[model samples]
Target: MKRVLVGIKRVVDYNVRVRVKPDGSGIALDGVKMSINPFDEIALEEALRIKERGAADEVVVASVGNADCQQQLRTALAMGADRALLVDTASAGGAPGGDLGLEPLTLARVLLALVQREQPFMVILGKQAIDDDNSQTGPMLAALWDRPQATFASKIELAGEKAIVTREVDQGLETLEVGLPAVFTTDLRLNEPRYVKLPDIMKAKRKPLDTLSLSSLGVSSRARVKAVRFEPPPQRQKGIRVKDAAELAAALKQKGLV
Candidate 1:
């Protein structure tokens, strides 16, 4: 039985209230809620489906976040992961400076230890994280592991120690065949994610989630970049309503955005 691993992250859920600031960092207003990122959920779904199809034996979900993230991991387990692992970023007094703010390369470095230990047949993840919107981690991990990787995968197939991955190219869908021990970063069209039933949620409580520290992984990085100011975007102007078709056409023509 081969082992499949998927990367998951707890982030400000996409549907939550999002206030994009002048510099683009979203502001969390009072009582704003956070949840597992949507893209990651899509990846998790694909992994679960692959498992259900018996393409692989077990689905192991792992994440790097604060303690609150464990709930999200449990949610992953509920969704059908055989087990979970949380690389604790807060227990050891947080990421030295704050937020770990680690670049994709830095994260790949940190995760390599876990990856080496797990030695999964395949690694799956979302094309990009909703919060950071950086699509670099999965590819970075593949490079670190010296394995083949396909990104933005919309469709995927596995057989005879190989994977046929389909992704949306600039013009249309493009397919590529890669050998096993490959990596995939899935897009939204890959598969539909499942919701946790009460029984599954309860069952998740019994699934094991191993925890580890960054120091244990021996990860070090220079704070190459840091966000300084947070400012909200300018409020939008009130809409200018048009009554007639001609009026609408004329308005569109005036804006030259038709």
Candidate 2:
């Protein structure tokens, strides 16, 4: 059976206001709202659409994080993923011990291990996660797997073992064809995800959700990059209303912006 693998991430919801820790350690997460990365949700929606069209037989969603991430996985199942895998790094000593809170490279390694095990025909992910916004995982996973990649994909069409992808580039759309077993990162223009009904939510609770230890995969979760600190962007200076064009010009001149 042809299988499609979709990578999901749990992140602070887009609506939530993120606050950097006072100690500059990281963002505060206590009792904050969390949701599946919006882009990943779009990727999963695309994967499910491909399956529905009979181009794929199964859609598997995978996430790497602590047990708290399973809630997002269940939500993916409710949305139509056939199965879920949670690569738990917390059991191996947590983030401080280099086993959790994975950086992009380590996360790519974990996804690589899953790819080898599942042997899916294709892998799909969001262009970037809202939390970190690194936008690096898809290309890194493609490099690790030695497969072609299409990033910022707005449209995907399967033709036999090949995929025709249209990507959103700064200069407009660029189309390309890649053989199966490739990686794709979705953009916002992709199809809208279906709302999970209450019945599906209940059914998802019974769907298979397998948990695996990062150690068991034999992949190193050691972070190659460390966050020294996180600081919010500087606030914009207040703007003043000008009485007329002359006043605006005078203000601009005073600020040396003209």
Candidate 3:
């Protein structure tokens, strides 16, 4: 394979507590924590491993977010992406996100144009983001591109312009034969990702990263779902205390016909 595209994201750090407002419009994150999305990291790791295995020529990591995403994008570079793309969308005046976060479909639109232009041999995505838990973008992009896709992939093989993917299914394991120019969403079991060495980290600073805008790709940033209000949830009621196992059984019996 010649070129591989890896979709990266920036999200709240994994340690932060996330709560949604009553209106379902926004999250109550304090902005005190942030990091690269985990799924994307798995994708990057698989792509780099493919390169290490002499399967692919280059790996590129891309992210759609505001200015702060650059630092996170650089992490992918440090992890071994040959280049990067940072997409900006807030300028179009659309509400960037609510409690649910940015729409994955919109980001897919931007990548559609990119795929057409780059014509990469394959595209890789994380199965889901930790916060939103919406695993739609990868499959959505595959559908948009009309290419076969494999998810939860633990092993991948590229040979003679065809990709043989091994993924985990409910029963044992399932394998698929897909041509080049396919999409893959990776799980944690794919492989262990490597940390960047000092030399590669320094070289990453010189790597080229081009900025792309929604307008340039002829895609709009408007979100279909509107979030109008936000509020906190009612405090959960405490559980009642029972004296012992016999008392708990007695309470249950008293509350019911038993």
Candidate 1 per-residue C-alpha lDDT over 1-258 given as tens digits, one digit per residue, 9 for 90 to 100: 678888888777777766654554535544667777787888889888888898888998888867888989999999999999988877555544343256678778766777788888888888888876878998898898888999899999997889999997788999999998988998888888988899999999999999988778887654565665556657899999999999999999999989
TM-score of each: 0.90, 0.93, 0.84
Record all residue pairs in model 3 with backbone atoms less than 3 Å apart, i.e. clashing. Answer: 22-231, 25-99, 26-99
Best by lDDT: 2
The C-alpha stretches of model 2 lying farther than 4 A from their native spots are 96-100, 243-258
lDDT of 2 at 217: 92
Worst 10 residues of 1 by lDDT: 92-101
What is the RMSD of candidate 1?
A: 2.6
- Taking all chains together, the TM-score of candidate 3 against the true structure is 0.84
* Residue 1 in candidate 1, Cα distance off native in Å: 3.9
Rank by lDDT, highest first. 2, 3, 1
- Candidate 1 regions off by >4 Å? 20-26, 95-100, 234-236, 253-258
Ranking by TM-score: 2, 1, 3
Task: Rate residue 48 of model 3 by lDDT.
Answer: 89
Model 2 residue 24 CA deviation (Å) reads 1.6
Better of 2 and 3 by TM-score: 2
Residue 30, model 1: Cα distance from true site in angstroms: 5.3
